[model samples]
Target: MKNLIFSLPFFLTLFFGTHVNAQKISDGQTIEINGMSVTFNILNKESVEAGGKPYDRYKVSATVKNASDKGYNIRLSSYPQIVSNIGLVELNCINATGAKLTSKKIELKMKAQMINVSYSAYDKSGKFTTNMIPITGSYYFDPGDTISDNAIFIVPQGEKPDVSVRNLR
Candidate 1:
């Protein structure tokens, strides 16, 4: 019983360690998740003044491609994270003049056909129009579709941070 108890913990750790390890991804590398290929890269980094304080600004780009035959709806805005020696920094956008910048989250919808009909008996001028309103917080990907967008993240000055994208499966 004593030998079994000692070996059981070791065996359990060995069994679970492989599954718990996260795959380390380098910069500008692409990973496929659920038939969607995601690529994240830090384009540019510089020092900028935001809210009267110096901060590090990063221009990051993310691209997603749908390689599957089916469509998928996924959110890409919340996937990027910045980590430094001080730990995870809050991601936000700020301009050079210390003004907070608001970036629109990229949301894509699968292309679909829509039919609009107008039936007017007394009106001589009958027109059909389609209006599209942008929706926030989600995006849809169709087969063979690709999209790329750039965002800015500001962090404290003098901090060297690394960008990582959370797995989107």
Candidate 2:
């Protein structure tokens, strides 16, 4: 009884301590593509002060890992509206901003998937309400690499926006 009782504390400590000290997984979501691992996490968004106005914004970060030995040419949005595996990537433009962005349009050049999924959309609510909004910029990825980026979004004061990517084309 003494040995069993004494060992219980040590065993419990070992198991519980490891789990407690383990790395904190943001969003705890992962998606694989072309043998690459993509982990998605809700970024620690900050208040944005644009156009002489300060507003809170939402952003998501995606970490891609190229595990394959062969180098694959991949293009990803540093601020993809939706980090999904269905090739339905987008950039929320209701409150999105980036350096070198074109004043006319913001193209989401997601030229990675086999299908021709070129489009855009808007983000205005806290839910998944996708829109086809144009974007700008060109970014790509390669093999044996791990990269992460954030996408900014807007959640209007009272609207319940859709969180799912929409085929608003």
Candidate 3:
């Protein structure tokens, strides 16, 4: 009987341990996408005062892994926009100065998933850009590698909307 009681506590922890790491975020949530593991968390956002102007901004981080023994290419792209869900927008990147950079759109073939939009960057300039800035095709993760996503978003001027992000396994 003593052994049974002692084992009961251990059993509970094993049964519920997997769910303890799941998380969620707002319209612009930082999600980690790896094989058999995904996590979501709300991003910390703020505007930089440059030339006396405010640029709306927020950032989310993600890590991707190749996991396979061989060299593999991983492409990180946006999911779709949430539909009929007010006060929400999807953006791919933000610069160090807090200005949103325009980019080429990425289409995620998320098999009939509920996500609504995928936004990537379109770099028309041939100059090299890096750090706290939004640029497309600037970085890509490789085998046995992890990287930060740095997803960004802004509230439409003069209006605020409620949002919720669901973390899916």
Candidate 4:
């Protein structure tokens, strides 16, 4: 009886702990973390030419709102990633084989006069870039304020992968 009682608590903890730590979010789903409400979704997919090369681009969007009464600074630890049958593919510049493609990571120089900055991939110059949530620095959010941003993921030709947002909090 004593063993059963002790094992019951352990089993319960194992079950609930895994549930809380599963950070994978799907399209149009919202999750609340640290008094902030965040929603992630894939908006659309299209073909585009970047730097004279043709590739498939997926547009993923994220919406974040300050639910707390007090203002605070927030930033994403990592951007959303493309998951395929092989594995999780990250944003990179090098192209690899085996049903997976590489993505480009943009490095930007922060201007001294800029405050409350956001990112986007749409440039008039036709260069490939991702307009992602600011992972470089924290942005201040007032109470009840919301911010929406889009990220463009470039994949190899004819490859469509599922998107997943993890460790967003």
Worst 10 residues of 4 by lDDT: 105-114
| lDDT tens readout by residue for model 3, 14-105 | 75663444343334344443341222233665654434665445454433334545443323354222322211112222122334552211
lDDT string for model 2 (33-109, tens) is 45556565556555655566554555565555666675543444554544333231232343333422312111222
What is the descending TM-score order? 1, 4, 2, 3
Q: After superposition, how far is residue 120 of candidate 1 from its true place, in Å?
A: 4.0
Higher-TM-score candidate of 1 and 2: 1
3 against 4, candidate with superior lDDT: 4
Candidate 1's TM-score reads 0.47
Ranking of all predicted structures according to lDDT, beginning with the best and ending with the worst:
1, 4, 2, 3
Instruction: Tell me how far the alpha carbon of residue 164 in candidate 1 is from the true structure, in angstroms, after superposition.
Output: 4.3
lDDT string, candidate 1, 23-57, tens digits: 33344878776676767676888888866888787
RMSD of each: 12.3, 18.0, 18.1, 15.5
Tens digits of per-residue lDDT for model 4 on 34-83?
67666766689887776676777766666767687976444434444322
* Clash count for each candidate, listed in order shown: 1, 21, 11, 3
Q: Which scores greater on lDDT, model 2 or model 4?
A: 4
Which residue runs of candidate 3 sit more than 4 Å off their true CA positions? 1-40, 46-56, 73-142, 156-169
Of 2 and 3, the candidate ranking higher by lDDT? 2
Candidate 4: what lDDT?
Answer: 0.52
